[model samples]
Target: MSTLTVILLSIISLMYSCKDNNTAQSEDIKEIKSSEATTQLSPNTTTTKDTISIDKSTKTNTFTSSPLDLLKQNEKAIVTLFQEASPSVVFITTSVYQRDYWSRNVYEIPRGTGSGFIWDEDGHVVTNYHVIKDASKAEITLSDHSTWQAELVGVAKEKDIAVLKIDAPKEKLKAIKKGSSNNLIVGQFVMAIGNPYGLDHTLTTGVISALGREIQSQARIPIRDIIQTDAAINPGNSGGPLLNSSGELIGVNSAIYSPSGASSGIGFAIPVDVVKWVVNDILKYGEVRRPVIGVSMVAENYTKGFGIEKGALISSIFPDSPASKSGLQGMTNSRLGDVIVSLDDKEIKNNTDLILALEKYKPGDKVKLTVLRNNKEMEIDLTLGSSN
Candidate 1:
């Protein structure tokens, strides 16, 4: 072992060690590339993706997907849903007549725009009553951009539901698949399909914020059993379908609790259960066919007044009406009226309660009404009839 020989031996050992280190680094690089090939970003996050690996040729880091595609599953499901449901959703435009100030000529002007859904293969479109309210003419535009004149079929203003018939071909019409809202739970995934702000076939996704909600319609009637969601429902989204994850129609987008008429994360919808009955009745009888007691009740919430804390008072009975035929007396100018206490043994606390109870029955159904008249309680048996 001379000095030169020893130095040569040490250099050879160092070379071997360097070779081993280089091989290890090469293996590590291969493993890193393999891991990158199989990596999947989180679905819940939409943040910007960091630079993954630098390319020696390009001298810059390359990214695989956009921040938007982080939630690929949710996005794919929404896209599929829109494809299936968008055809069922239709755009609605209403027109009203107005007299010009200068020309004094009556002209039909576009009143408002809204959204609706096809109810059946017969081309019955369902929308909010206010959407076509006071409109002398209306037009429905399908997803394929074909416009058709709509004929008014039936309407339930209290429920804010209106059915319009279009003579669209069956091949062009797609009826929405109905789902029951009776089993909905809060926080479940929901999607809204509509034309919001005149945007056609817009899809907004959210969770069910609440259920069994109540809302007032333009006709001053309380629409009960509403479904509330955070989906972005705006001005033109009215009467559109609110769907569950299965692309089933759960509710109809009716109103929003926004200050600026924009989506403030609070939107209301009429449940499908109510729409089911309302539409069925409309198809059968051309209207809701709700039984009328044929007694005039004071307007402006008279049933909730201080004089009569509860019970719907009979203001006046129409001649040849069920009440008139049953010899029911109405209130006069100087005295009080017959306050309806109960119907069919159901407790009627106020006029709204009476209306709701009556909604459970149809025209020509026999019902017993217990009334408080002249400080005495009496039962009156009357066969329900149409209000005409």
Candidate 2:
């Protein structure tokens, strides 16, 4: 061959070798990227990773778990809660007897239905007073679908709490675990299990929207220190237990703020603090024992008309009782009397204050009181008496 032909052939061979080397390097790089991306997906996945970039700002909070696995875990937790709590819940059906004018037959008429929870191993059911109120009798359906006739154990109508007892075996009764509602904060998660609208065990979830609400009881007494939640509470939900995420009983579902008488997202529950007190009292005293100071407070309007802005004015005093014997005087013909302004270290601004303060103590406990009598302030050490 010629010298120019030999030189050209060598240059062409060198160029072809470099091109092949570049292609091999490109294939090796592609294999490495494919291996790294394979860890993020399974064989059955069709999701595209290009648009699924993880934001670095949320790196600390980002989940490194498989979505399906996380979903399964959450579903397991919810199922466990329902299974653990449903045993403590019961369905209450109330009935009354009505006489037919035409038939002269006393037929059992169904009044309403509500929910309750077992309170103790003795098959004691705790529910709202208005639920079993005025009903001739009630039938309790246990979690096992066993029906039992319930007998009234005791009731606190002022607080709208009632207890019923069934003759079931201890193995059939599952008492709920109690939790505190006093330290609850807004936005904390809560769960409500009840028979809303008489549909068997229904579960609703929500958060504590607010706290320290007030509602009226069937006895016309004010129920204070209520916990407000967004949990759906309807008519049948009354007497059901309101629970925290841990499945502990925190409150008793009582009233709702819906104009249509349904779940309005504004539901009030009787705090467990009050429930504990009432349940203890009923189990001991057969009813709520109110501590009385033996003095009736003046009408709020009557006291306000005299330019008295604070304190509950004394209207009348039960003769020979704590207030009367303690030299406490009441309003005479001129509507002038002693005004209770404080009890111990707590301030009593109105009748509500006085009543609530009295609730903290039992009968025969000595309490110090500060009252305004005839525009003069004085302190009295009085013995608290019971209105039993």
Q: Please give each candidate's TM-score.
A: 0.77, 0.81
Displacement of the residue 370 alpha carbon in candidate 2, Å? 1.9
User: Local error of candidate 2 at 217, Å?
Assistant: 1.8
Model 2, residue 200: displacement in angstroms?
0.9
Model 2: per-residue Cα lDDT over 268-329, one tens digit each: 99999889989988888888888889988776767789778999888889987999889988
Clashing pairs in 2: none
- The 10 consecutive residues of candidate 2 with the worst lDDT sum are 53-62
Q: Write the per-residue lDDT of candidate 1 for residues 50-111, one digit (tens) a residue.
A: 64443244433346777676789768888998899899999999998889999999999989
Q: Distance (Å) between predicted and true CA of 368, model 1?
A: 3.9
Model 1, residue 296: what's the lDDT? 82
After superposing candidate 1 on the true structure, give the runs of residues whose Cα lies further than 4 Å from its correct spot: 1-71, 99-106, 299-306, 319-327, 332-335, 364-366
> What is the C-alpha local distance difference test score of each model?
0.89, 0.89
Model 1 has an lDDT value of 0.89
